[model samples]
Structure formats: C-alpha cells, structure tokens
Target chain A: MIVSQKPIEIVNILTHSNRIKTFYLKLKDRIRVAPGQFMMVWIPDAEEIPISISYFNGSTMGLTIAAVGETTRQIHKLKIHDSLYVRGPYGNGFKIPRGINKIWIIGGGYGIAPLLLLAKKASSMNVKVISFLGARNKDELLFYDQFKLLGEVFASTDDGSEGFHGDVTTLVEKYLSVSKTDLMYACGPEDMIVKLIKLACNHNLNLQASLERLIKCGIGLCGSCCLDPLGLRVCRDGPVFPLKILVKLNELGCYYRSPSGVKVKLSD
Target chain B: MSINVSLGALSLRNPTILASGILGTTASSLIRVYKSGAGAVVSKSISINPNEGYKTPVLIDLGYGYINSMGLPNPGLDEMIVEFKVVKSKKVKLFGSIFASDIDEFKYLASKLTDYVDALELNLSCPTKMGVGLEIGKIPWMVEETTREVYKKSKVPVIVKLPPLVTLIDELTLAAEDGGASAVTLTNTAKAMKIDVFSKKPILQGVYGGLSGKALKPLSLACVFKAYEVLSIPIIGCGGIYSWEDAVEYILAGAKAIQIGSAIVSEGLGIFKKICIGIKKYLEENNIDKINDLVGLAHRR
Candidate 1:
C-alpha cells in the first residue's frame, strides 16, 4: 500500500450538473499518470472513489466526477484550495497501440475524462487525434476546452441541444466514414462499447475499449472485480483491453461464477 | 521491527502480504507489487478453462464502499501455470489463488499449482458475480470437501480464504482444520451493490458486487476475533488494512498477519514501505520486543 500523505490542492472546480464536478488537482508531489489511468480521490469521511484522469500537466491532475452518490456528491462540496487525499495513476491505461498513424477517441458522459487525456497525449505526439464526445445534452459533456486543445473534436447529445443532435456513436461512425482512422479508443457506457465493438468489427477497424467492470481492490485481489470469460481481471489485466480479446470470452471476458460456484449468465 | 508471519514452510519478511485478488494476474504486475514490500502476493482466481467473467460497468463506488461483481475471470489452469511459473522465478513468496465451478475442478487446479508456489490460497469466498464464490465459504461441507482434496494433493500448505458473511465461524474453521488446512484466511470481500439514480439501473453489469476497503475492516476484525476463539490454525486477516495502526489492530485482534487491498489503489506501491516504517516505530515506542506479543492481545484483555 502506497500512502500519499501530500494533500492535493483543488485549483479549479468545473461543475457539469447538480451532481458532477471536475476537480483540478495540484499535487503536493508531482507524478506522471498516462491517459485512461485513474486517481483515487479521498473525500473526508465520504470514501475514496476512482475517477479517471481527464487532463494532466507537470504539476496538476484533472479528475472529472459524476455526482451520482455520496462520494461524488460530497466531492461536489469541495471549494477551491480545499484539500483531499489522492493516490494513483493506477491500472493499465490505453496504450497508443503500435502501427497506428491516425486515431479516433469516442467518449460519452464522464467517459470523456480519460479520452480527453488520450487526445491530448496523441496531439503532443502529433498522432492526428480526433475526439467524438456526447452527453445527455450540453451540460453533461465535460472537458470541452481541454479536448479542443487536443485535436479536431466532434460533439453530440441525446436531445437536440448540442452539436450533433444524435447519439455520440453516430458522430463516431460519421467521422470514421469521412476520414480514415487507423485505430480507435472508446469508453463510456457498456452498451456504447459493445455497439462500438460491433461497428469496428463490421467495418474491419482496429478498436480498444477501457471497460468499466465492478472492482473492489483496484490492484486485482478481491475476486469481486473479475470479468466474465476471457479469464482476465479488469483491475489487473485491464480497465482497457483490445477488441480482439473481448470477442472471445463470455460476459465480456470475465470468469464470474455466483456465490454458489454456479456459472451464471451476465443477465442473471 | 515489523512482524513476520508464516504461511507454511515459507517465512515472510513481514506480516503484511497483498491479499489474494490484488494485482496478481500477470507476472509483471505481481513483480511490481512484490517490489513494493508485500511479504507475499496471491495470484488472481483462475478456473479450469478460459473464462471471460462479466460485462462492463463491473465496478461502482458506493457510500460505504465499492460494489463489484467481476466474477472469477481468468485464463484456464494451463495459462495460469505459465504465469505462476514466471511469478515463482521471481523468488518472492508467491501464492496461487484458484476458484472452480465444482469440487473436481478445484482439486485439479490445486494439483497443478501445488508444486509451483510456496502455498495455495483457496478462494471459497466471493460475492456478487456468482458461481462457486461465497457458497463454498458459506458451507462447511463444501469447504471441507474441496480443502481436503486440495490439501491431499498439494506439496505445499493450504489456506482457505473465507468471506466475512459466514454466520458460523467455528464450524467453518473446524471444517477447514478437518480437511487438513495448514491455515485459514478470514474475511474476503463483503457482498454489495451500487445503483445509478440517473439511469435507474444497477451500476455494474452483474448488479451486485463485493464491498472491500476501509468500510469492511471492523466486520472483518470481528470475524477474525471470532475465528481466533475456536480455530488454533494461523489466520491471515484481510479487508481494508491501510496503515501500521490498522495492521497492529489486526495483530491485537488475533490475526497472524494482515493483507492490504484498496489502500494500494489510493496510496500506491509506496504504502508498503510506509507501513513497515510505521510499524517499526510503533513497536520501538511501545517497547515490544517481539511481534508475537501483539497477537491476540485484545482477546487476552
């Protein structure tokens, strides 16, 4: 267990809704975390939750959180200069996979957090990165300015209140049709990842997904975090995996049996 | 100054080992954790065949703790053998944790892995996703049968990992002893769930999950105390040990050693060294000469 005694100062707070807020963290001790990786933000008495790192410079780390429950809602209470305990840059982050020149990053809701980091890193490397983001309307779409600095960005929403008045996946597909991207990275809803995997397969494009699996101990012990079939742990082996591996195993490549040791279906 | 605990023939440098299921799937990750100062590390649960465990949204943060139903996702025994072999070569006190859909598979997995590592951490506890998870730990007969088979086949010592949910600690502990377990690990993650208020849905693909982290420590400590009352075998205590104070509490509560989990995510690999130093300072200040003196002190009081 690595203890981060240094208190991370809240430099900025970007609110997405009544529930969600993005904390701009200035670390007491600077550490570099890759895109698609996450930080565990400790809110006093509220419990620590893993939020994906949306953006990072040398001294600061950005955490975009949806104020859904106690932890997130409590996190929303933080004012500028308020301090919290944080650790990580944990888990397997999205690798800029080799042999890819141009890449498309598709994100929805809070999923835009990690994708924004990916886009920024790609832009730094001059990887021709393009980001397609969506949310319920305009309010839910986060990191608008940061993502814009990364690449050519496309936006969408469920209601006609935002850029592309349709699903974010529609924007992703539209972009893929217009411009050729060698590789794609996606994170958001499970349905969205599944749908994107299907689209990539149908179109014969390379795809990688940062899956959202139930995890207890992020380091991979609790057995609570096992994925269904591919016999891989989302905590250890992934939060990010290539679509090629996802196509094989059951329940999105987890080996989950019920408490009775009975193999149950994902729906069950 | 930190306490040292034994799993069997192997002597750990410290009592705090990374509990089974924390970053043990790959050789690289295991090595990274070992270097972090855990006396030992347990591999993730591997089954008989290739298993893709669950779908996406497997993890969610709840008010109390985390709810995850990842299931027991892993490549089969054959693939795990390769991974375990690499782990063993690292010369750390590596342990293998395995789960099966049935008794026969558990026996088979134990037989294959027994020769490769210092010990076998049998996972009889897992909540949420399903399959031979919490059921085995919850039932004495199932624990006895599977542990018996594994103990008989293994060259190394066997440790049965139990969930904290068990209502009968004495019965389960005795069952493990009858099956020839060298030791028993108390308190796996607790079953839990998180709901998305916006979507009107369960946060995880599997819906329910196991809760770990600081929220689970008290219940886990109570379980350890209860199991220590009847079972003479060494018990490995786990569930939300983050600091030296937490580790010392487990010792006082009667755990031979403790395992650290969720803290690593929030803290990082540096936690191992920090805890070691903190424990040393505590011992030095308290004038305790040996780690054993701290064990079960609360029970004595």
Candidate 2:
C-alpha cells in the first residue's frame, strides 16, 4: 500500500533522562499498531527517524526517544499538543501465542519501551507478567512505575543506586531461572539479546526478540535493515523476529562499514 | 487521468520508474512495483553468470543520499529468463537492465533476455566496481563497440545507462547511437565512501559505493542535459529525484522520463505516486499539457 503521512498530536511528554524523552501521541484518527512496529517520525527540514512504538493506548502512540543524534534531539524539542508527521505501524510485530498462562518480558536501555507496551497487552489476556528493566543509572531507568503497576517489576541500575547492583540482562536472567513461563519477549542491545536467546533456548522457552538496525526507510526500499546470513529486511519481514531465526543471524555482531564506505563495527 | 511518456514505441502511464536497484532485485519485486503504481520498473542489473555481490553492510544511509556497493548481485541470464516469463501484468511494462565484465557476456545476456522483455538497459556505469568502471564509458570506441555487439544480437530496444562524468559523455552517447541504442538513462551514482574516526577504517567492504539521492541531482541533470544535446533519442534521467521539482528539473533539462531509487528508501513506495501527483499539479499550474512539451525547455535560455 502507498505509505500515507499521518498527523499525530502529542498528548504528553515524559522526560526519561537528559538525553531521552517519551512522547505520548494521540492521532486525529485511530492508529492501528502492534508490538514491535515502528513509525517514521518527521522533523521538518532536519530528518525523519524510525522510532519503535513504545506504548499505545487506544488512539495514542507512545515513543521513547534517545537523543543519540541530531534528528532525535529535534524530536525531543517537540512540545505537547504539537503536530508531528508519522507514517506506518510498519513491520511485523511480536506474535502473541494463544492460551498462554504466564509470560516473561525483558528490556534494556531504551529498548524497554516496546516490551512495556507488550506487557500491558499481555495483562489483558490474563497472563501473569515478570518484567526486568535496566539502564546505566537510576536517572536513565525508564517506565519503572508504569510496568510495576501492570505486574511484578524488577529494575536494575549499573551505578548501584537502584534495586539491583548490575545490568538488566542479569536481572532478567535471574527471573527466567526461577519462573515457569509459556513465552519470553525481549528488546535491548544485541549482546543482551544474544545472551537471552541462549538462555531461552537452553530453558526451551518460547522466545521473541526485537532487533534494531540502522534504518533509513520504515519500508523495505533502502535495504539498510538487512540481518546477516538470511539477508531478511527488518522493515519488511520483521523488527520482531522469533529467537529461532534471530539466533541464526550471522552478521549480528560483525563490524562493518556504513553506507558511506566507512568502516565501523556493527557493535561498538 | 493518465499521462504517457514515450520510450520509443513503449509508453509509460506515468513518468516515474523504479530505477535500477531498489526493489528491482527480482521478478516478484518488479511485479510488486507494478502493483505499487510505477509506470515502469527496471530490473536489477543482471550478468551472464551468478554474482554473490559485496559482503554484508553493502548499503548505508547518508542524510540526503545513499551509498551501496552491492556489486551487481544477480542470478544470471538463465535464471532471469524464468523471471521474465512470469511477468503477465501487461499494464506495467518490463525493462531488463544487464551488465557484464566484457563484451561477450553483455551480448550473450542481451540476446538471451531480449525476447522476454520490451526493452534492455545496458548498465555500463555502476559505481560499485572498478572492473567495469568509467573505462568503457570514458572512451567513444569502447561504447560504440559494446553497444554495437549487443544491439546486433538483441531484438528489443536498447538503452545505454551512463555515468554522471562529463568527460566523453557526448562521445559515448554518439557512439551508442552509432551502435543503434534506442535511448539513454543518465546518470548512475557517483562512486563514494565514508570513514569512521574511532575505528579508523573505511565504511564499506569495498571502500566505495554508489552515491544516490539529492546530493547528485545537479550533477545528474548536467549529464542528461549534455547527452540530450547530442543524442536524438529518449533520455531517462535519474539521480536524487526526491520531489516533483527534481523530476521537473530532469524534464526541463531534457529527460523524456525519470527514475527514482534512494528516495524510496527514506520515503517508502508511496513516493512514486506522490511524485507523479506533484508533477501533474505543477504541469497543470504552469498551463503545460503533455510532459513532452517541457523537454529541453531549459536549454532555450
């Protein structure tokens, strides 16, 4: 289908850190979105960035912003009630299994956003939730209370100022070790997912993962979001892929050059 | 309402084409483009044999452009014929773009796919590889000899895709016309690369990639304008055409049609229809009728 730009109104802006903010946008028309889907957010003349929908309630879309570059900083500068251009609900979302009794969800850094939304969705299905979220410090820790209200929440900060003295991945690993679950969902740094994927596979838990690639178009045109080995376009096949497929991604950690022919490792 | 931009005997319902690369990788993608409303779609440049192309991280995104060193990844002529046979949708015309390391490979693949496609695009100016670099295009005799060989054996109309380099472009176009080229598509992305300061390394595996998007529009326009001045054939201008204004620049500069690649990456597939609509609005506002009326209009000054 032709991608149409939709104008969404920002209902609220929750500042998560000095570098990151979360925008709760309510569209003029109802927006249909699934967990793990992303929207191309427009920033007038600067640039358009692909941001995963962190949380959405009815007509509202929540975007957790990390001001990693110029475009996102511009996005951060937006005020509540400001008009923002958006296109999509693009890419395949996390596949919700039927008859699940309990589910485990994990998030790290800004990746915690989408899984938080998924957790809220799972709650309505009557699935018991265990969430482990982590950031570098207490200030960078996001959405702790929102997730805590939904279910049992575990928060970790690297600087030892929070619940745990280590990383979120460690906390999720500990939870997974003790919990009986039907499925596991995770979003975070590649290393975290790699560790979680191995853990999920070892425990024989059903696992789904949301991977972030250098995205140019939210659609499949640019070929920038290709995962290694399978060469699957994240914009088309998925931003959320089953751990079964994600585990086989060979270029997941290989250092490579950007499109400008500059050499940079995929993970720094 | 529809507009037809003539490419020899073939007529495109709109001026927007998928351009080489992008979604032109396979017949299924080409079919998808036709379904998406592109008046025409050029197949990815194919070769006589299978090519694995550059390693992972072959494509990168610049703010207003893209650089890719895909190395003409293709499934060979034999595999491409199977793809050609399945294009049943008559509404969107198919154009097969082919490249080769040498003359024999070009002729062989051209003759093989000619019967299956309406037109053949000779890809002599890919920015990724130096083996098939500007050497052939920089010389008049090389262009004449290669085009002559392919044109002699192929039954379909031939379009010589040119690089953005100004040097010897007229000579190359003249040579292609001499060898019986039906039209020309100008211009391919210029070769470029990026570097990372922390890692101290080149960005692409090949150290160079084809640059496309708004960064190359002015250079591409110059190539089309120059080629149009010398060649009495249809010209398909492509390079950083992100808006209708860019497409109009191509037409007024002397392009009969235009192709879009990198913009689709940032804008999505809807860009084609959007550009066509914008072009229509501009034309209507300017009291222009057929798009042909504006071709070469810029040269008057």
Candidate 3:
C-alpha cells in the first residue's frame, strides 16, 4: 500500500535547550513505531526532514528537533495546535535481543532524543539501563533528568560543566574498562559513533547505532541517503544498523552526500 | 519464453529497466539495482554544474502516486564521470541521463558520458522551473536540435525522454526521430502539485513538481500508443509501471521496453525481478514465444 503524509496538529510543545525543542503531535490513526524509526516532518512549503520518533504512546508521538537548517528553523516556529504534515515511522529501528539483562545507551547532543524512548522501553522490560549523554555544555545536555528516572545516567560536556569532563565516548570507554554490558545502543555525531564502534569492538559488545544522512525521500526510492560500497539505502535498509553491518560501511563517519550528491567529508 | 528485447544497439536480458532518478545517483546504487535483476539502469539526471536542488518537502506520497520537485540535484558532470567509471567496470547496461537547457550543454554532457555508458538518455522532461526540464522538452525544435547535437557528438545510442501532457505526441516523437534519436522514452512525470489545506500552502517547496505512480500509468500508456503510430524509433515506456500486467500493457501499447520508477518506493529493488517474472508468466500463458512479438499488439485490431 502507498504511504502518504497525514497532517497532524501539535498538541504540546516543550523547549529542551536553546537549539532544541520537542513537538508532540497527535496522529489520527494509530502507528506502530520503534525507538529509532523516524517520521518525515513537513512544514508545508518550507521543507520536509526526517526526525526520529522520540516519544510514542498509542496515537501521540513526539519529534525532538534541533534548529540546524532552514527547514528545521521553520519547524521551531510552530506553536501548539499548528499542523505539520508527516509520513512514515520509516526505516528500521533499534532491536533489543532476548535474555539481555543490561544495555548501555550512548547519545550526544540532540541525538539523545531517540535514546530516551529506548531507555524508557528497556527500563519497562526490566533491563538495567545506563545512559551516557553529552553535549557542548551543561545547558545542551538533553533529557538528563528523564534518563535519571529510568536508571543510571552519565552526563558529559565538552566544557566540563556537566557530570563528566570529556566526550561521551571517553566516558563510555572508562565505564567499559570497569564494568560489563550486554549491548550498546548509540545515536550521536559520526565522530562519537565511530569512537563508540571502536570501544564496542574492544569490549566485545554488540553496537546498534541510528545514523543520519541527507535524506530527501523518507522512502527508499531516493538515493540521497545511500551508504557507499554496500549501496544500502539509509532510508530503507536502516536508520538503525547492527555492529556487523556498520563495520562494513566505509562511508560511515567518513563522508555524507550533500543535497547535490557531492561527497562532503565529515568534519573532525 | 525469451524476454530479451533490443532497443537499437542496446540489448537487454529483460525489458524491465530501472527508471532514472530512482536510486540512480551513486555507483553503488546502480550496481545494486543491476544485481537485483533490472535489464539495465539509468543514472539520475546529471548536469554540467552541481545543483543543491530545492529544500524538502521536495517529495510527497499522494497515496496513488508521488509529487516531487527535487529540482535536478546532481554532483555535476565531473563527479558523475567518476561514479560512471566504477559502474563501467561492473559491466552492467548503464544509461547516462543528462539534462541541460541548451544544445551546447547537452552536447558537452553527452560527450563526457558516452564512453562510460551503454547509451545516453537526454532528460528533456523533468518537471521543474529550472528552464531545462519541461521548458526545453515542450519546444519541438529545441528537442530536435538538442537530440541532433548530442547524437552527433556521442558514439553510443541517444534516447530522448519526453515530457508528459504535451499537446502533440506525434510532433515530439517525430522531432526526436528527425534529430537522429535511437529511441524515445515516452513520457516523464506529469507536472502536478498538492496543497496543505490547513497551512493554505502548496506541499512542495518548489510549489510545483512531477507526478509518478499508479495514477500516471494510463496517461503514459496513451502517450506510448500515440507515439507508436507515427515514430520509427523504439519507444521506451516510462511512468507508473508497478506490476507485470502494467509492463505487458505498455509492451502491447507499442513500448519496446518499460521503465520502473515510483513503484520502487513500495516494491524496492525486487520490483525489477518481480515484474520480469510476471511478464514471463504472462507471455508463456498467452503462447507468445518472445516479448518483442507482443509490442504494439493492442493496435493490431
């Protein structure tokens, strides 16, 4: 069946930080969405962008967005009761294997949005939840209090104003040395995720990461979000991928295609 | 049943071609589609210079189809050539689709891509306000001139993809034939738009875009059927082909081959193989020995 965008009104709005805000929308129909699967949020006539589902009940879903581009800036202007056209709950989401007692959730900047939902779900399943969240400063750390309520929460900031004085990956590395976890779930900047991949490898932990790309069509038809070598459509094959597949993607953390299909190198 | 069909100098194992602009930007994507059982694959429309394209809401699923105004985004000829080199090494039937506003630009793009591709498809019909797509395609003389110039400069076969909803299918087809086009792709996406009633604004960032999917099938088939009556060049039917029956209908309507586009959104790469299987089953059931024998069958009566 063909999937079309449904215009949903923003029921509530929450300001998370200076750059980030969460828009809670009520869907007309119930949608079964996983933690990392995203929605193509359209701010009519402005642009459409993929925002991961940060919160979902039966008919209500929340999209936590950072005002980084022009379209996102438009989304930030939206108030409660405003309509945003949305399609999907697209792409694959994070999968928690059975019999796993504990898992580490690593997130950085606004990436913590999707991981918060994961923490909530995992906590409900009686799985021990340890979250490591980082941002540029204490003010930027996302969902710290929410994560604390679920289980253990480690907050990091680049300027040393938060719980840990370094990057979240460094904090993860320090923790991995002292303790053990069944799996590691991450959603963050490419550099942070790449570092986490290495740590996961050394610690022999399976890692599942929600990656980002320049997505035009949330459906698989557009090659805008395709990864190199494997030619996997990031929109279809994954926004969330396992450690086994992530290790083979040469483009991961190296470069991402621009809107014009140019390979722009990821900034170090 | 022998499903192989030949379009001038280009031969396909089957008539199911991966339509341009659907996962055709990267070399890896082309290879992936090729391996998924498409007879050939067309690259996304490339241009002389890099284009950032329009901002999103560039595309929307209309339930029956999609309306998109991607604005011909590409990494310029230089980067595409690098991508083509990798695809060439894999030995897949590759068609380089290029779009330009003028004859000189078309000639330049065709010359640059001819070496790496099996054929060059002139994208004269993308529905954008960029003064290139339907703007150039609508003018019959411009179509003739661009096709003639590119065909002259290029060593491989040249295919002209025409815009849909034009006044005269015969004029466009004859113009391409007179300009030495080896084949013609009968119809690109129809110019269309959608609006958000709540916002009181057009859904696409570009205000207008091209429509593709199940809704476009009959329109495209009509174009192919009309073009078949007047043109000598092979007709490559494109627009809204989703299933095997759709492929058969296009073939009977006089299309030597068919292109699969928007359906890939729902069917994935496997659509190629699925449609091919369906066509073969159709031919076998109908007692047709070859797929070529079915072309223009609808006009036989």
DockQ of each: 0.08, 0.08, 0.79
> Using lDDT as the measure, which candidate wins?
3
lDDT of 1 at B27: 64
Comparing 1 and 3 by lDDT, which wins? 3
Give the poorly placed runs of model 2, Cα more than 4 Å off.
A1-117, A120-219, A222-233, A240-268, B89-91, B130-134
Better of 2 and 3 by lDDT: 3
Which candidate do you rate higher for DockQ, 2 or 3? 3
Q: What tens-digit string does per-residue lDDT give for candidate 1 at A1-268?
A: 1232135789998877766788887765757787888765665445555678887887877888887877677778889988765656677888885566789889978888788878877777778888888888787778776777777788998887879998888888777677777888999977788778888998999888887755544555444445543336666677888888766544652234443223344544
Candidate 2, residues B1-301: lDDT per residue as tens digits?
3457888877888999888877565455677677777888898788777665665345555666777777776667776677667764444588999888789888888888888888999888887875753357667788888899999988888988888887767887888889889888888889898764434566566789888888888899998889888989888999999888899999999998999988876676788888889988888888888899988899996
- Across residues A1-268, which tens digit of lDDT does each residue of candidate 2 receive? 1154445678899997898898988766666788888987764444556788888776777888899987777888889878666777788888778888888788888888888778888888888888888888877778888888889888888898888999777787677666667888888888888888888888888889888775554567644455544546777778899977977876665643243222247657
Error of 2 at B117 (Å): 1.3
Name the weakest run of 10 consecutive residues (lDDT summed) in model 3 chain A.
A1-10
Worst 10 residues of 2 chain B by lDDT: B196-205
**How far is each candidate from the true structure, as Cα RMSD in Å?**
11.3, 11.2, 1.8
lDDT order, best first, reads 3, 2, 1
Worst 10 residues of 1 chain A by lDDT: A253-262
What lDDT does candidate 1 reach at residue B169? 79
Worst 10 residues of 2 chain A by lDDT: A255-264
Interface RMSD of each: 10.2, 10.3, 1.1
Tens digit of lDDT per residue, candidate 3, span A1-268? Answer: 1166667899999897778999999887866988898988876556678899899987889899999988889889989999877888899999989999999999999899999889988999999999999999887787788899999998899899888888889898888778999999999999988988888788788999989888998888878999999899888999999999998889987899999999998873
